[model samples]
Target chain A: MNFDMILAAAARLDGHARHTPLLSSPFLDQIAGRRVLIKPECLQHTGSFKFRGAWSAISALAPEVRDCGVIAFSSGNHAQGVALAAKAHGIPSVIVMPADAPALKIENTRALGAEVVLYDRATQDRDEIGESLAVERGLTLIKPFDNPFVIAGQGTIGLEIAADAADLGVTQAELLVCCGGGGLTSGIALACATRAPGLRVRPVEPEGFDDVARSLISGKIETNAALSGNICDAIITPHPGEITFPIMKSRCGPGLTVSEDQALQAMAQAFLRLKIVAEPGGAVALAAALYRGDALEGDTVIAVVSGGNVDPAMFTRALATL
Target chain B: MNFDMILAAAARLDGHARHTPLLSSPFLDQIAGRRVLIKPECLQHTGSFKFRGAWSAISALAPEVRDCGVIAFSSGNHAQGVALAAKAHGIPSVIVMPADAPALKIENTRALGAEVVLYDRATQDRDEIGESLAVERGLTLIKPFDNPFVIAGQGTIGLEIAADAADLGVTQAELLVCCGGGGLTSGIALACATRAPGLRVRPVEPEGFDDVARSLISGKIETNAALSGNICDAIITPHPGEITFPIMKSRCGPGLTVSEDQALQAMAQAFLRLKIVAEPGGAVALAAALYRGDALEGDTVIAVVSGGNVDPAMFTRALATL
Candidate 1:
C-alpha cells in the first residue's frame, strides 16, 4: 500500500526468497532492434514471481495467525508459490485449484506439501471452496494479486530493476510485465515511481484476454469475454483486481497485447536466446517487447517473464515453433 | 593457471560476462536426496560457460594480436562463445565446426559473427582446418580448453561457486562439473582448491565418453573408443587436454559418469524444476548429482549445468522423457 510497506516486505523476503537474475542476449536485442533486458522470475522458487508475494504476505502475518496456516485459490503458479512458502514457514497450506489446471502444477503443489482441493471451473466456485476452507480451518486466505502485501512483495522486483538499470547506465526504459490482475504491474509501477523515476511500468496481456489494457484505455475496470481458450493459462484473469486497478490507472503506463502465437514464439525465443524457460502466459511481455516495438518508447525495454510452470507438452509445442 | 589469473579474468569479465545465478529447487533436492544447488551457466552469454574462457582469452590477448582476430574449433557451445567474444572485441573469428553438430549451434555460431567452416567429424580434421585458417589469416588460435588463459577464464565459475556457497552457509560440498577436455572441471578444481578447500570439484562425463573418469581412475590419460555417438555431444572428447588433465588429476576429486538416459532426464528436470535449459552434455553433471549419489560425498552437492546449445529436436526428446 505504501513505500515503507514494500521495504518491510523486502526485509521479510531477505534470505527467504531468491534474488532472480536480469538476463539479456544479443539475439534478443537484434530481434527487438533495441536493448532488451529480461528479469526471469520464472527461475524463482515455485517457478514464478508469485513466491515473493506469497512469502511477503505469509512472513508479514503475526506469528499466531501464520501458525494457523494459509489458504489460496489459483490455477497454478500462485498455488505452488503459496504451497512452497507455507512449507518453508512450517505451516499447513490448503490450495483450491481448478480441476482443469495443468497436471504438473497440481502435482507440484502437492509435492511442495500443500493440501490441494480441486474444483470444476465451470460448475464449482474456487473462491467459495477457498473461503469455506479458510474459515473452517481458521487459515488466512492470501489473495493472489489484490492484497496490498502481495503487491508490496511483487514491488521488490521493481527495486531490483531500478538498481540493475542504474548499474547498466540505463536512465530510462519501459518495464514491461505480463498482466493478469494488474498486481505485478501496479506494484512495479509504485516501486519504480520513487526508486527509478525514469523507468515506466507497462502491462502486456494476451490478445483475447486484454482486460487490463481495455481498462487502462477506457478509464475503468474491464472484463474479458472468454479466457480458457488461450494457451497462456497462467495470466488469464477475467478482470483486474479492485485494489490493483486504481494503483495501475494512476501509476502505470498504457498497456499492450500480444497474440497467442507471439507468446509461444516468445517462449521459444526465451529458450533459444536466454536458455531460460518462459511459460506462455509469462512470455507475453517479451512477445510485446520483441514484436510491438513501434508501440513502445525508449532505446531499452525490460520485460518481466512472470512464470514458467509449463507442461512438457506445451513446452514441446513452443520448441516446435523454432 | 593459478588463482591470481582467475581473479584477473574475473576482473576483465566484471561487466562483459553475465554473473550467472546459482539456482535450486525443492523437487531437485528431493530427487537427489540432498541439498542440490545448480549453477546454471546455460544462462551465460552464448548459452554456456565457454564464454567466460573465450572472453578471458580474447581480452587478455595483446591488442595487436587480438586485432588480427581469433580462430577455434568447436561442436557448438565453444564456437558461439568465441564468436561472440571476438565480435565483442571488434575482431573477426573463424570457427571450424563438425557438419554433424546440432543445426541450432551452427546457425547460432554464424549469427554470432563468426565465419563457419564445416568439416566431417569422422574423415576431416578440425584442428588442421583451424590451424591453416589461423596461419593464413595471421589470426591467433584459441584452443577450446588447453590454454592457461582459457582455463583461468573458466575458473571464474569456481570463484562464484565458492562465494555463493559461503553466502548459503555451505562450508563443504561436492562441486560437480560437466567434463569435456577437462577444461571446466580442472579450472573449477584449481579454483576450489584455494578459495573453497572443502568444496572438492568432480568431473562428470557421459558413460561411453567417460575418458576423464577413466583417466582419473587409471592414473593416466585415457581416450574414448569412439569419437562420437552420444546425445551429450558437447562433452564427447577423445581425451583430456594435456594442460587440463594435470590440474584435474591433482586438484579434483574422483570422477563420475552418468548414462545418456540420466542426462536427458536431468535436462527435463532442469526445465520442469529449475526452469532453465540444459543441453544433454551440459546436464551430465546434474545427472551424476541426481543419479550417482552413491559415489558422491556430503549432504550438499553443487552441479554446474555447463551449456544449453541444444537443438529443438533434442530438447523435444528430453521433454518427451518427462
Candidate 2:
C-alpha cells in the first residue's frame, strides 16, 4: 500500500521487464483536444503489464516457496505473465483457464511452458479449482490483482509515466488507466500520488462492466452482473478487489466508461496513428480519452494501453468496425 | 559520411525526434535461430525514420532557403516526413508524388499542409517534374536519399541500435536494413562501422528491384529495368544514390533480396508478434532475417522495421495471407 513497495518492485524489475515506449500521435491529440501520451504496455514481455507483477511476486518468494512452484487462474494475459515469469525463475507453473478463452492466449500460455487446466466457466468456479490445485500440489497461488506484490509491480508503470512526462517538461497531466479489478488503476494512482503529485488519475472501463466507475461514485465496491457479453474480456472482473478498492477511492478521481464501438475505434486509431496493436480491454482508456473528450482537464493526457494479446480475427473485426 | 555528422544530427534531434523503442520477440528469435532485436521506426514521427532525415535536412537549411520553402519527390513516407518537417519550421512544402500512390499516404501528406503535385510513373519523368516545380517556385529541392544531412539523420537509428544492443550485452550482430536508394542502409553501415565495429551490416531489397544487391556483388552501380511493378513502392528506387553508393561500397556487406510473399509474411509476423504495423518496404529487412535464416550469424541480429504508413487494405491483405 505504501510508495516504497512500488519503488522496491521497480528496483526488482529494472532491466528485467521492458520500459515500454511512450508514444504520441497528432491525430489522437486533435481528437482529445490535448496532447496524448500513450504508455504502450502491449510491448511488454508476454504482451501485458501483468508480467511485472508476476515477476515481482514470484521472484520475491522464499526459497522453499519458489521450489514448490506456483499456480494462478486467468483467461489469458495473467496466465501468460505468470507462466513466463515462472519459466524465467526455472519453476513449474500451472494455469487454470476458462475453456472458451481466446485460442491465441491459451496457446501462448502453453508455449511459455505452463500446464493448462481448463474449466467450464458456466459450470465450475475457477477460484475453487485453482485453490484446490495449489493446495494438492503444494504450490503458491499468485492472485491476479489482489496480491501486494502484483499491485506494487503494476505501479512501476506509473513511475515510468511520471519520469517520461517530466523528461518532456510536463509537470501536470491527467492519466487514464484501463480498470479491471482496480489493481492497475489503484497501483498507478498510488505511484502518481507519490511520484507526480500534480497528476489527476482516473479509471476507464467498458460500458456494460463499469463496476469500478459505479464503485467510485458510490464510495463502495460494486459488481457487474453480466460479463460474458462484453468484448473486453481481459478486464471483465466481477468487482473491484477488497484491497484495491480503498486505494482507488482515496487516490483516483471519477471513473469513465466507453462503449464497445468506441473501444473498437480506439483500437483502430492506435493501429493507424501509433502503429501499436491494442486489445479491446487495453484500448478502453484511450477510447474514453478520444470519445469522451469532455472530461479532459490538462494540456497533456496519458493513456495506459495495458495489453495487446489479441486474436487476429478479433483484430480484423476491430479494423472492420472502423 | 563521417560519424561526427551523425552525432551532430543526434544532438539536433535530441528532444525533437522519438528515441524509438528497440523490441525483442521470442517467436522471432525461434524463427531466425538467434535473438532478434527490432528497432521499430514505425513508431517514429510521421510513421517512419524519414522524419529524422527530413528534420535534419530542413532544420539545417539557411533561413532564407527555409523561407523560400522545400520540395521533394517521394512515393509516400518521405513525402509525409518532408511535409511535416517543413510545417514545423513554418515553411511551405511541395511534394511530387506518383498518381498511383496509396491514398492514405497522399491524404496524410496533404493533411500535414503540403502541396501535392501528381505525376504518372509510366509516362512522366518524376525527377524532371520535381526539378521544374522547384525551379519555378524558387524552392530548395530536398532529394530524398541523395542528400548528406538526410543520410546523417538516418544514421542516428544505427547509433541507437548499437547502444541498445550493447546495453543488452550484445556487441556483435548481423544488421538487416531495408534498402531503397541506400540512404538508410549506407547510413547504418557507416554507423555500425564506427560504433559497433563487429556488426555485419547488410542491405535488404525486394526481388525484382534488387539493384542494391546486384550492385554490391558487381562492385558497380546497377539499375532496375522497371519500377512500377513492385509492391514495395516506398523502396523502389531505380538504383542506389550517387552519394550513398560509396558509403555502402566501403562499409556494407553483400545485400539480400526477398520475394514479395516473404515481405508480406514478415509484415504479418510483425503484427502477430511485435504488434507493430509495417509497410511492405519496411518489412523487407525482417523478411530477410526470418526467411533467409541461413545467412544469420552471431547470437544477436537486428532488423529495422523502417515505416508503418501502410494502407489498411494492404495491411488486411498481409494478415489474410498468413
Top-lDDT candidate index: 1
Docking class of 2: medium
Q: Give the C-alpha miss distance for residue B266 in model 2, angstroms.
A: 1.4
User: CA lDDT of B33 in candidate 1?
Assistant: 91
lDDT of 2 at B109: 85
Candidate 2 off by > 4 Å: A100-102, A120-125, B99-102, B119-129, B132-138
| DockQ value for model 1 | 0.79
Cα-based lDDT at residue A208, candidate 1:
80
Superposed by TM-score, candidate 1 places the C-alpha of residue A99 at a distance from the truth, in angstroms, of 4.7
Query: How close is every model to the real structure, measured as TM-score?
Result: 0.96, 0.96
- Reproduced native contacts, each prediction: 0.81, 0.50
Q: Which residue pairs in candidate 1 have backbone atoms (N, alpha carbon, C) closer than 3 angstroms, thus clashing?
A: none
lDDT of 1 by residue, B129-170 (tens): 878888899999899999999999999999999998889899
Please write out the lDDT profile of model 2 over residues B64-97, one tens digit for every residue. 8789999988757888889988998899999988
